[model samples]
Target: MKRSSRKQLQNRRAIWMSIIVLTGMVWSLYKLSASLTLASASLPLTELAVSPGKNHAAPQNGTSRYKILIDPGHGGKDPGAAGASGKQEKAYTLALSKKVFDQLRQDPVFEVVMTRTDDTFVELEGRAQIANELDADAFISIHGNTYKDPDVSGTETFYYADDSFVLAQKVHEQLVKSTGFKDRGVKKEGWKVLRDSKHPAVFLEVGYLTNRNNETDMLSEAHQIRTAQAIANGIKNYFARF
Candidate 1:
């Protein structure tokens, strides 16, 4: 073969090799750029939060706290029910109501109010009136029960208006699980406090006071705390859906 012809062929081969190497480098760079773009697009929300306490925070542009009204069933001279342990329903109701109220007050998410904070007489009509006047988001009247059989020991939750059903169901479900008591199930009743309230309202009969075992359990400090926690959790769960 001639030298010039051989030299031309060698130069052409070298140029083709360089072109192949350059093309491979360009393709690798493109793939790396694509990977970086995808990583940036899918970054975690926590990493992007500009302020402290904003991580995983829900959008609360103009949300306001919910107002809750609690009514102790009976107070003052009106003892709605009597227990085997010689405790009046009024006393137990007031105590439990306060506990539940305190539990809910821990979070700034709720504005808590009680019909009767102490052993003071407040009529059924008056209770509903307070809730209406305050424009409460929800109302719950707490009570204890009594029966001749004394064997009937369980929790009872009642709702008067159609809007009250969801609150009753949620609170009752959580109470039943927390207390590990017989679930009497959610019921419907036209109690004055419930029926008259403009906002959603529910009545909770904690347990049959006539039952010695239930009466003792309800009076326990531990059970009261659990009961209060359960009610708070239920209320929170109810609001979470909305």
Candidate 2:
């Protein structure tokens, strides 16, 4: 080969190598930015608004038809599930439950009461006792699930004993419809809060945190609000029949 041609070939090889390095660097940076975005995006935007001084009397919208208690699972030291994007299941559950409360409050008939409005933790038994004290028509515990196999994703509802099956059915069906997640069906479990409650009660496992798809969806405010609205609507429908 000619000396000039050899020099030209070397120069071209160097240029191609530099292009490859630059492309790799850009790709790495893109991935890093995406990860950071996900991490920050998972943070909860809503904290408890109602304080001890706030009146517990259900907000008056119109007619007084029913009284319900909503229990947001885990809080304070109890981070229900460690999500892939560093989201805490406890925070998500609380946010969703609050949305449900707001939806129910819109209907003057529903006198909704939450077990805890803040980040404080309430014992499982204490949660049920509060509902009993209020003589709630029904009790609903809001929670998220987790699994070793990150692929497991779905909504499951559990009844304390048996009489609460109807409530579970109503809530679970609405959750599946709104979230578009697999319907794990109503189950029977002796969850502490459900077992000791005087009124009929059910516990909801919204979705598996270990699953990336579920984690992403649960982190979204829109999804949480929709889920809450669906549960509220289902409760209304269930009571309308009575």
Candidate 3:
């Protein structure tokens, strides 16, 4: 009821009001900062700021290019078919596949990958899985053929999927022309590699090891080189359409 007492009470009230306002503003600022942090963490990796000196440009059309997977059939424990002279199918396939790999690597447009670079045995399904995992544009499986009759001698290519027919045709054409072998032509077959492959795939029975002539030519270094070139050219021709 005293005037001095009323003034002192009003001053205390003013100080408490000021404190309450300041506390609310601090809490509001803290919530805003926490929300901003959460938003930043939720952003996708591609949307994040890249480190300095690093290039993280937006993906350009057609810049990713094509990836090709070359698989040499059989290896290590699996000798595959054997010629009369004891030359194994695994050896020939590896030799030829390496040459093909080298040829494709020389071209900038193609990115080449191999299933097995050495004498290692890769499971049948695993070979196809590799191509699928890498998202290969094409899968070319190199192999040699065998038959009960030695007279069965020729070059043949097989495809399981409709999308692979064109690829098989292109490669088979070059194979027959380059190797000077009888054109067995391209045929459809549900080979594991061809069947399991997500992309276009071809299984090449290059020649019959049972045939004396076919085996001899396949064993030659010169023949292998030319055949590799033919295979690489065939792949290039197939990709040129797209």
Candidate 4:
């Protein structure tokens, strides 16, 4: 072989090796970042005492409707996570909540109350207060996930209360099954709303907005409906186990 050809071959191999090394380093950094993200965020706060109030629901089949509080995480000026192009986590949560509320309202067994029906911000403390005031049977807060590593994607459920574990498990299962997203599983978080909620409460990190595929799927109307139905089923299933 010619010396010139050998030199060219050596240069090609060096470039390829450099690319391989760079890719490996980037991937290792991403894995470490993702592990840190999950590890750093799990904590749960104790419950609060709030005043009680009336629920507007007529009895059906000798049973009154279960008051369910549906909270869409962040709204108004607070766009929770801007992890995708032209997509805000707050918007996704609101959209999903609306669909969930719609599904629940159709059932005479549930009296659903929304934290915010439109684009608005309700204080985190106020959200918990509302649920407590109604003496809600269950409280579900909807949210989207975000991570520094855009590839990290899944459905994660969180709860601070003991009674809320089943709620989280049931909801998380249905969400994972319906969405086909990776299951991050049920976790514990000291988020103000769930921590302070007087009744069984759970927070759902529905899908990761940082991931392009997950974000794209989350934005779809069909996917949103499917997610809503799964959640509604979970809520019903949770109550049945009592």
Which pairs, if any, clash in model 2? none
Estimate the lDDT of model 2: 0.83
Scored by CA lDDT, what does every candidate get?
0.85, 0.83, 0.88, 0.86
Number of the top candidate by lDDT? 3
| Segments in model 3 whose C-alpha atoms lie over 4 Å from true places | 1-64
List the candidate numbers ranked by TM-score, top first.
1, 3, 4, 2
Q: Extract clashing residue pairs from model 3.
A: none
Local error of candidate 4 at 130, Å?
A: 0.7
* TM-score between candidate 2 and the true structure: 0.73
Stretches of candidate 4 exceeding 4 Å from the true structure: 1-63
Query: Model 1, 37: alpha-carbon shift in Å?
Result: 16
Question: How does each model score on TM-score?
Answer: 0.75, 0.73, 0.74, 0.73
Question: How much does each candidate deviate from the true structure in C-alpha RMSD?
Answer: 6.5, 21.5, 15.9, 22.6
lDDT of 1: 0.85
Estimate, for each residue in 130-150, the C-alpha lDDT of model 2 and write its tens digit. Answer: 988877888889988998898
